[model samples]
Structure formats: C-alpha cells, structure tokens
Target: MKGRTIILDHLNGREAAALMLDGQLEDLLIACDAPAPGTIYRAVADRPVKGQGGMFLKTPDGNAFLRQIKGMAPGDELLVQVTGYADEGKAIPVTHRVLFKSRYVIVTPNAPGINVSRSIRDEDRREEILAVVHDTIDTVPHGIILRSSCAAADDKDIADDLISMLALADQVLNDDGKGPETLVEGDEPHLLAWRDWVEPAEVVTDEGSFETHGVLDAIDALSSPRVELSGGAFAYVEPTRALVAVDVNTGNDTSMSAGTKANFAVAKALPRALRLRGLGGQIVLDLAPMPKKDRRGFESALKAALRADSIETTFVGWTPLGHAELQRKRARLPLTELLN
Candidate 1:
C-alpha cells in the first residue's frame, strides 16, 4: 500500500488523533509547533464529557498520570503537546508529554425574565449568539460540527448551523421525542474521498434512463462517460443445492461455437458485472469449457476482460468440476445481495 500525508490545520491534537484512528488519515505523524519534544499544549474537545477527558502525562515513577481538569468547551481553542513514542517490537506506545490549561468563554443564556438590551454592533451579535449557545447547551445536549465555512464565516453561517441544530432539538421535543433520530445529515466525507481517489472511467446503470443521485452526479462531474443501457445478459443458475451460479450468456448471437463464443462473451461481460453491480465476494465464472487448443486463448481473453475494471482479480485456473475459478475484490454490497 502507498502512503500519503493529510494535513488538518487549526485542529487541536485530539481531533487530529481521532481522525487518524478512524482511518480517515493514514500514516499519521503528529507534530506540534513547539521545538521541544515534551512541550505541553491544549485544545478544547469538540465533544467533551465531564470528569472523563484529559491528556495523560508521565509520572516520575515511569507510570502514566491521567491529568483530570475541566474548562474547555466545544469550539474553544487549546494547545497540544506531541509526546514521544515507545517501541515494543511491532507495537508502538504513545506517551503524552503536555497538558492544556485554559478557561473558555462561557456562552450561556441569562435568566428567562431578565430584559437584555439589543444592539446592532457585530460584537453585540457575537454575544447574543453566545447567549443562545449557552441556553441551547442547558436545554439540549448537542455537539457542533464545525464547517469549512467557519474559516471565513462572518457570523451568519455559524448562526445557521446552530439555529438548525436548535430547531431540530425543538422538533424532537415536540414529537414525544422519539429515541435519537438524525437531526441533521452531514455530508459523507468517505464517499467524496473515494470518488476523488478512484477516478472511475465509466458508469453503467441497468435502468434505461439516468436519474440524478449524489453519487452518480459526482461521477458525472468527474467527466466519466455513461455506459448506454443494453438488455440484461446476466442470469442466475442454480446448478446445485449448495451454491448459486451466475452465468453470462451470448444471448443475441448463436452462430459461433458455444465454447469459444461463451468464453469470449464471459470475458467481455465480467468487467461490466464487476463494475455495474459492483460484484465481489467469491465469484465462480462458469465459462463454456473448450478443447485443449482453445485454453490459452480463453485465459488471455479473461485477463484482458478484467483490465478495465480497476480491481485486482486472480484467475484461479479451473475447478475440479470444470468451472473457471476467478476472485474479484471485496465490496460492501453486491448485485446478488441486492437481489436476495
């Protein structure tokens, strides 16, 4: 596997660590701005729990000391220290070397009956928003998802996400407050990353006409050509009670030899099957077995068939039962799963 660096700036250390653990970032080497190896820093937890979260510092006895302190709130800034790592053969130990100690600007609402004067100044709006935030924290337990708009956000965007979250909380309160439904659906970053990484050449759909879906739209936006729809050539065959079989037939043409034609057709259609339906798991390609002289040609054709799909495939020669054995990459869901 190849390695790459993903720089997540302006994020405190814990946020960066969480992202690394989630496999969103690979080969993470955390570094701090300070020159020293054990310099301490701190940042507010995006999702903080009372009496639960803190950085671990090493004691004089060579044991870890879990430093427990409180002050940080969501979106509050903190400094973080990058500690050294201990190696135990293949296993590497991470040691925390610093602490984050700072008081956050408390944004909480005043008493309900208190009459507060309104102001038109920008600073006034900031204070007002902070007040709403404080009220929201007290009334509803919710976390914030800092948006990219936050970089140059001029109060409006931040207010919008906050307001949206509040409205969702109110809706939950009104409808007997069913157990934890999604209040807001954030963009799925993985799909976007996958799209950016794997530039698919063509997208084919079984449905004759193309409809706009976010995934399909993203593919189209990358200028991938649309594979025109053709009549279904894929079929399911129940050859035995233990296993189900999928057969690709040359349905339209019957003039050529069954063995040669079948081999050619299977070779041609395998990639389409892999991509269109995203087939994976152990796939047994049952090509029509040809004479001894045709074996080499068939193998060559099968190899050529798989080249366009962008998936690593292994040709496992032939099974004892005479079916051609092939293995494609694993996918989350396949056409067979959908059909069943």
Candidate 2:
C-alpha cells in the first residue's frame, strides 16, 4: 500500500488496469468497444478528400481517416494502423506508418536502425544494450528501438523480446492477403499496463483487489471535475465537446502570492489530472489571477511537468485573454465515455 502497485481487475464488465504510487492512483486504463489505437488493418483506399490532403479507407471497423496522402488513388490497398480514438460520428484516426511495440522493443518498418533510448546516458549501459541488440538481430528488415525499460533488463530477456517483436513485424509486413482485414488487434488494458508500467512495483491480480486497494474509490473521485492539488489549491478539468477547460482556484491561504502559488500547484498537477481522466485534444487553462510577471514561471513549471509525461502534448503559449492553451494527442478514449 505504501510503494508502487499495479492492479488488474474488471470495471463495469470491462477489463481495467490501475497504477498506484505511494498509495495514490497515478494512471488508469479501461477497455471499451471502440477500435483501440495501434490496431493494424489492411484497408482499401475509399477516396481522398479533395482539399484536405487526407484519405478515408474501408476497414472492418467502419471508416478510418488517414492524413498525409502520397499519390494515393482509390481502390489501392495499403496497410494502416489506428493512431487514436475519434470523436462521435468522426472517422477513426489512423496513420500509414505502423509500429510493432512490445515490452522492451519497438519495431519500425519504415525506419531502419538499431537505436538505444537517450535516457540511458551511461555509455557502458548503452554499449551493453547495443551489444544485445546486435547479437539478437542478425538481419534488420525493420528498425529496432530499445525502450527505456531495457536499461536494467536482463540480456537474455531483452534479446527474447526483440526476437519475438521482429518475428511479429515480419509476419505482419509479409501478409499477401488481397482483401481488407485486421492483421493484429491492439493490446488489452491489463496487457497494455504490463507493457508500459515496467517500473518495479508490486503486482496485484487477486479478485476484488480493486476494492481492497481503494482503486474503485479513486476512480469514483475522478467522476468529479474537482481535483484537490497541493497546498489546498484545487482545479476543475471539465471536458466539453469542443475543448477541455481548466479553472484553477487559490488555496485557503490568502497571502500576496496565493494566486501564483496556486497556479504553480495547478501546473504540476495538471498532467496527472488529465492523464487519469484520459482527457485530451484542445485544452485551455484559466489560471488564477496572478501577475503578468508570474506567467513565465507558470509556463516553465507546466512545460517541465509535461516534458516528464509520456503523452504527446504541446503547450501552444498563452492566449490574449490571459489564459493558457495546449494541444494534446488523443491517445486514449475519454474515461467517462468508457465508464458510462
């Protein structure tokens, strides 16, 4: 209960996973009926939008929109992977580039190279991992990327994962089928949690572990928009159809720097808030009324926080009405939508 723990269980008849750190829920993943991101499909090009430089494809799971056209013509067949979830009535967002990812290795069919994660700054570790890669992989038809989890991983285990992913990539790429079909399905919630949450943590798989470990309570709290931040400050993360709106409120201490301090707290907690709620896309922050000079500090704190996050988010600078704007990747479906 004190250290990190990974809990796998069912929520609302759907498989769910939760990551807890120091007795606090840090991340959550829940399965849904929609087409999960990373699903590979051999689709037939339906038609290209005249001026949008994008094309829609016919897949088993309804229409999928893939941006970036490269002389693509109708009736042509190509392999595409679902990139992220789409809004209601919108085409599933997909990309031409497909990546085969596993716990330790990611195979890139388009890019060819054996690369190590930049986080492994130790030269010796890099050399050792590279040695493993070179030894495990003889012929490189696809690029191999060693994830950060490989830093302290066993040599034999890393090699095994690399081999397995390489074989999978080859099998998917070499499919000679002519009709549109699904090549591979996306990883489920529990499997995805295992792949990404590789940090040392206690594993909880017993029945009713979610209730025993307070995971259900934590998820219930997420139903509310109010997120209590440090120093008694709070923030509301409400997602509308168009965008996510965040409003920060100062803590109980009404000091001269109360607004600035509350704003800093919001900045630090914002990423985790959005992450647990699975909220993304356009985000606008109406931070507490701090002095204009303090805006730079808030931005710096938010940028640093987001940099530490794994999700792809871009801080698009402040707005004219003294608000902050951000563009985040739609990597997962909204938690509320899935739960409901």
Candidate 3:
C-alpha cells in the first residue's frame, strides 16, 4: 500500500482534512465537532414529537434527536454520544451507545462483546487476531473490537494500545460536575480518522504547505472531473442525488489485449477513486464487459482493493448488463459538501 498525504484546511469557523494518495483526494473529512463523534455530552430530554417519531434532547449544541426515546422524560438528564452529523434543518443524531478507540481497537462502554472488522476477509486470520485480543485483555467490562489494522500489529503493540484505551474509558466514565450542553471534547475527529482510519504518511497544513511538500500544488493538479489512468484508460465519476455513477472508458486504446489491461486498471482505479472522493452509497460501475470467468477474477481484485477502505462496503455482484453493484455505508458528508 502506498502512503498518503493529509492536507488540513482551516478557515473562519470551519476545518477540513483531505487525504491525498498519489496527489488524488483519497478521503476527505469535514470537522463538525461541536458535538463530534466520540464526544459525550449531558442533555435534557424534551417531549417527544409524535409527528417526527423521535424525542428532542436539549444539549449545549442545541436540541438533538433520540430516535428510540426509551423511557426519557422532559426533565431527565442523560449522557449521549453524537453518532451522526446533523441533517439539514434537523437535530444532530445522538446515541447512548458510546465507544472509545485506540489505533487497533474500539471499546464500547455499554455493549460488551467482541467484534472484528468486516473488511478482514481471512477467517483464519480474523480468528487469530480475535484470540489475541481475548487473551490479552480479560478484565475490561466494555466490548472490545479489533480493527483491521490489528492484523498487522504484534501482541505487545495490541496490549499497550489496550491499556491506554482502558485508561481513557475509565476517565470518560468517571468525569462529573460538567454543566448541561457542555461538550466533552475528546480527539479531534479528523486526527482520529487520520491516525486510525486513513493512516497517511505525511500531513500538510495551510501553515505547513509553504515548507517543502508542495501539497497545495498537488491538490490543485489532481482536482479534475475525470481521472486518467495509464494506457489511456479513464474513469468518469459523477455524483448524483442518490448514488454515484462511475464510467470506465478505454479512450483510443483499440487493441483487444490493451482493452483487457485497461479493464484491470479500471478495477484498481475504481476503488481508489471511490475512496479518494469519499463517495458512498449504491455505486454502479459501468465498464467494458469481460468473460464470466474474467469477471470473477476482477471481482476478487476489486474486493481486495476495497479492504483498504475504512468504511463498510458490500459488493452486490455484476448485473446482466455488466454494471457492478455495490453498497458502501455512508462514512461522511458527500464530496460536494466537503469541497464546498
């Protein structure tokens, strides 16, 4: 895997981080941490809106939604975690299920269970990693999940990371006396994603850009509508209101052998393109059709490529018309919103 670069843009009231791989935007994240992910805040429950099907919880940021409502009352004070970003004219999504993370693991306070990353395909390796996690940490009361990165980590590294996470978990659970609407600012959401998710090689900020990396210049050059791969192959990615559509065209490459090579290049490029743009949802890939046998090989390569991604993805197989169907769990704001 090639190392990526991180570019941080801070202006006025907004902050954003763009992960660049080979000068192309691999993963872009917006810092909307007023009530960020992993942040625990005290909120007062308000009356449930029968029309909306959720209760209003008043926190420091504002009133957020409690979808299930539980047994919360109008004056009840509760500790909640911001799960998802606020929708347009809607409350920030909050959940009682809070989880703490280290580089290789995620510890869930309320839910006590062992779960592994779905991206980890090798069942044997998954079992091996889970065994390590179970054997290393036995006293933790919270649920522990081994991240995909744990497969590459050794026993000592996992143990050290677990100890640190346990301490943080204890701290989060013991804190008291904070007023309502007060935000328990944990990690900078982007920094957590950079460290645990993307794991970029070099990070360049607006202030750091002038030093040597030419990160700003790279971002400028790579900002284009179409991505041109070697052998004159290209992927035209367009985002729609519902899902993103990517078309692979072998421009001016007439040889049959070259076309086959182009399709493989497109296979490699498709996952990278999707990751770079942060386009998730039902992804349709329209490519030059290959034989049924070849399609299986291509699908395997595609899945392997997607394993690098932090988000959850399900490859729904190819349609009769040869369009590849995929569903990726939305990880962040769309590319348009992030760029804007």
TM-score of each: 0.33, 0.98, 0.69
- RMSD of each predicted structure: 21.8, 1.0, 5.2
Using TM-score as the measure, what is the rank order of every candidate, best first? 2, 3, 1
Worst 10 residues of 2 by lDDT: 133-142
Tens digits of per-residue lDDT for model 3, 1-340: 2468776765234565666667555655566544565567777887798876678888878878887776667887777787655545778778777777778878888888888888788998888887776787676578888787876677678777877887777776776654465545645645665556534377666654422444345445435659787788887888887678878777888876655566788777776666656577789988764556677777887787777566778889878888888887655655455545
lDDT of each: 0.38, 0.92, 0.70
lDDT of 1 by residue, 1-340 (tens): 1223222321222111101212222211122221222222222234433465643333221222223336544444333333322211211111222221111111112112222223233565445545645554554333333322233334554455566544544443344322212222221222222222222222222232122212223223323222221232333432222232555454454554655666665676566545444344456766554676787888898888776544667777877766777765532223222223
Error of 1 at 14 (Å): 29
**Clash count list over all predictions:** 7, 0, 3
Candidate 1: where is the Cα deviation over 4 Å? 1-244, 250-256, 335-340
Model 3: residues with Cα > 4 Å off, grouped in runs: 1-35, 41-59, 62-80, 86-95, 111-138, 145-164, 171-183, 197-206, 210-212, 257-263, 317-322
Q: What would you estimate as the lDDT of candidate 2?
A: 0.92
Q: TM-score winner among the candidates?
A: 2
Provide the lDDT at 125 for model 3.
Answer: 83
Of candidate 1, the 10-residue stretch with the lowest lDDT total is 99-108
lDDT of 2 by residue, 1-340 (tens): 6899999999989999999999999999999998888899999999999899999999999999988988899999999999888988999999999999999999999998989999889999999999998887677788889999999899999999988998888899999998789999999999999899999999999988999999999999999999998888899999999999999998687889988999999989999999999999999999988899988888899999999987899999888999999999998888889888
